[model samples]
Target: MPEETQAEQVEPQPQEPETAPEADGRTDPWSDPEAARREIEKLRREAAGHRTKVRELEPLAAKAKELEDAQKSEAERLTEQLAAERERAAAATRSAVAAKVEALAAKTFADPEDAAGALDLTAYVDESGVIDRDRIQADLAALLERKPHWGRPDDGPRRPAPDRTQGSSGNGNRTPSDPANDFANWFKHSLDQAR
Candidate 1:
């Protein structure tokens, strides 16, 4: 065996491990489950308290808003009313145009709804809200020309009303619709019943 040198023969001395920096004395939630649970509970309580506060303040906030609206200037109130009236007027104009379109389209188109939907109608109403009937007619003509099938056909689905279907099975009791036949059927049925 080779002679052991003094350097090699010295045993390894165990040194103390370096201490980690201080952790602000707080428990690591991952390491302490109870601490994590307590923290969650505290947060929940705080959230509940905030919610209760909000509930108490809601009525006051609504009253404040109501007061603010009530204190508005007469001009501001009139402006609001004017805006609402203008909206209604626009809606009425559109409705009037739609009704006219529906009635007119029904004359040429098999499905008035389809024709009404297909037409670009915004231009039919002028800035003054007067409907331009001439423009609407022109547009309808152009649409019918572009899509010929949208127009009603002379021989399409307008067949004569179907006769009410009579039961064809030759077996069931036939109730006579005519009063003269009813008396004859009653006698015949009574005889058959006796048999």
Candidate 2:
């Protein structure tokens, strides 16, 4: 075995790193802890910078969209406005139709819920959103004829007799005879019951 010089040992060490298994041609920071930390810090700073740029651009983007809208041709703007008006008008029409339907249903159905579940309200409105009052009245009349029970149970309070004073004789204990001379008989009857 030969004794090696320090300079010779150091000389081969510099070349070994190039052919070392741990070495690769790439420059990514994963191979070095300090380099990875610096790279992570740099990426964080770049992300913060991009975030600030996005924040700065936010108002400009809104303004650009506004300007684009402002610069639209009159026909285009008018078309959009007309479309919005049409949508609002349609909503108004639907609301009006629903109100009318509810009012009509309240008059016709004994139960308001029955009108909601049993009837197809669209049948009362034409394509132009005009309600057909005649048709609704006729249909309700027809429904009452088909299912007579569906109508409001007669208009007054339900009771066994109309006037409470009418057909009721005096307290049911005595016969339907004059009571002027019946005190003794009534007393004896009461005593008998008490026994």
Candidate 3:
């Protein structure tokens, strides 16, 4: 083994040129600064055109959103109105049923209160708000037949005739002296005798 001098160690070496590898045997456009700048400028122009299109459509998009909101609000208001109308109709139906029941009860029973208490409104009234009069009458008849006491006159007992002798003038079987005083005396006499 021999030691080599520094001049012999420093032998000239062959150099290769620096170059980018070609993809599919074609040059990349990005390798040229001018081509890259042109590509960037083209992209910027396309972007500007897109921005202009978006700006042009903005008002139409806003109008469409506003219209949709207005329609939704109107639909909500109509729904509320319909609900209110249905409530009013239901209340009116109930009122009509009540009036009919009260009238029928008054007609059927000696004491209207007794009839009102005994009657079932639900049984007579249909879902469509129609009342069954025949059913109501039949029910009333059945009730009256079952409870005979309910049909009796409420005005308790009758009073006996007054005795004329107690309030009459001195003559044993006398007529009043004046015709005008006769009616007045008879009325007074009847009231006093009854008491």
Scored by lDDT, model 1 comes in at 0.76
Q: Where does the lowest 10-residue lDDT sum fall in candidate 1? A: 1-10
Candidate ordering by TM-score (highest first): 3, 1, 2
Query: RMSD to native for every prediction?
Result: 21.6, 17.0, 16.0
Error of 1 at 194 (Å): 24
Candidate 1, residue 161: Cα displacement in angstroms equals: 3.9
lDDT of 3 by residue, 1-195 (tens): 122244245444433343466878755546555454567668867988999999999999999999999999999999999999999987786666656656776755677657656777667778777888888778777888888777746666889888665685766686547877888999999999999
Please identify model 2 stretches exceeding 4 Å from their true place: 1-80, 116-118, 126-129, 142-150, 156-195
Which lDDT tens digits does candidate 1 get at residues 1-195?
Answer: 122254246455544444454589654553344444467667767988999999999999999988887777666989999999989987888788888888888888888877778876677998877888888888888899999999988765777876544565475665437887888999999999999
lDDT of prediction 2:
0.67
Superposed Cα deviation of residue 142, candidate 3 (Å)? 8.9
Q: After superposition, how far is residue 79 of candidate 3 from its true place, in Å?
A: 1.0
TM-score list, all predictions: 0.48, 0.33, 0.51
In angstroms, the error of model 3 at 124 is: 5.1
Which is the leading candidate under lDDT?
Answer: 1
Select the stronger candidate by TM-score from 1 and 3. Answer: 3
